[model samples]
Target: MLHALINGLGLGLLLAIAVGPIIFSIIKISLGYGKKAGYAFITGVCLCDALLILLGNVAAEVMRSALEYKNLIGIIGGCLFIIMGIYSFFFGKKPDFEKSRDIQVDYRKRDMAKFTLQGFFINLFNPGPLLFWLTTCTTYSFLNTNERILLFSTTLAVVFLTDFLKVNLAQKIKRWLTPPNLAKLHKATALILTLCGVIIASSVILKNFISW
Candidate 1:
């Protein structure tokens, strides 16, 4: 159990550092709506992680088979990525973050439910996230049933902590960076995400048919 918890913590930390749409969404929520929305976004991601964990546990075989169709999942994930990238790339109509301090929102409080649901869908549609959990979380052996549950709990704990910390830290660092630098960062994040989608697609496609 200790080993599983430690391994999960490491995986959670590394994944938290990934700069992608999810991270960008966290930043946008923070800058546009403040800490409440930012936290909402993080909560949504944690929920998504929990859902994947549950799904992997109950439907491991189905998920395993589905994720193994690398090219198919890749194509879908890639299309979503390319589309999101284009949208963000041409998202000139949206308010720039630097000028968003005065934007007024009318909700009594930010609807965390909405944020969470949207975040959940984004994760679900992406495919790779589920694939990752199915492969990484359940692929190995544990010493006992208690150990497995402990590992899942530890993974969730690490996920919540690391994700919240990253969102807050990125927003904190935003103040020091110039507009151009930030724009570049957003673009870079988009590219990396798109690349991940592509890699998943290529790997699966190759594995599905081409490897000798």
Candidate 2:
């Protein structure tokens, strides 16, 4: 159990660290709404991730033979990572607010249903999470079943917590940066994203060639 839990969480975190669109979405919403709203969105994302995990488990059970195709999983995941990095580098968005003070809208506070739902869909529809799950979830499911589930759940929990923390912290930190510095930060993030793409692509290529 412990082994599964540890393995699951470890893999989840590895994928969570990259500055993906979802992370930027958290920052954008937080800037417009507030820390609470950002956290709410993150909660939605977690639920989405949990759903994906369940789906992966079901798929694993149904398609046991499919799991052995590591190269296929890696190719798909690598392509996703590469695409996301390209998008981030070329066209990523940060939250845009003209004023530092929170918006004075009381309705958004009350009508959080839309916000939460949008957040959830944003994650579910986004390609990154799917590709991330394709590789990571399969890897997790390869372990002992009970252990894998426990590990996946625990790892996902930690990822949700950490991502929530990072997004909120980014919101707070962005407050201090001047426009130029913020622009610089965006550029840096784009570079990091591009780097992630390169790494994933290289891994896929390496795996492909080695098979020959």
Residues 1-212, candidate 2, lDDT per residue (tens digit)? 77666555655655565444566566667777777787777888888888887887777664456666655654555566566556765776653434434323443687776667767888899876776566555544445577766877787878887877866687565565556765665666556545655665576578679987
Instruction: For candidate 1, give the lDDT of residue 170.
Output: 67
- Residue 179 CA error for candidate 1 (Å)? 12
- What do the candidate models score in CA lDDT, each in turn? 0.61, 0.65
lDDT (10s digit) by residue, model 1, range 1-212: 67767756755664654444566566666766667777777887888888887777664444345654534544555555555556555662332455534323343473667766666777777665776666544443212456657777777787788767756776665664566766676666556545545554565567667665
Of candidate 2, the 10-residue stretch with the lowest lDDT total is 95-104
- Give the residue spans of candidate 2 off by over 4 A: 65-107, 172-212
Best by lDDT: 2
Error of 2 at 28 (Å): 1.9
Give the clash count for model 2: 2
**Highest-TM-score candidate:** 2
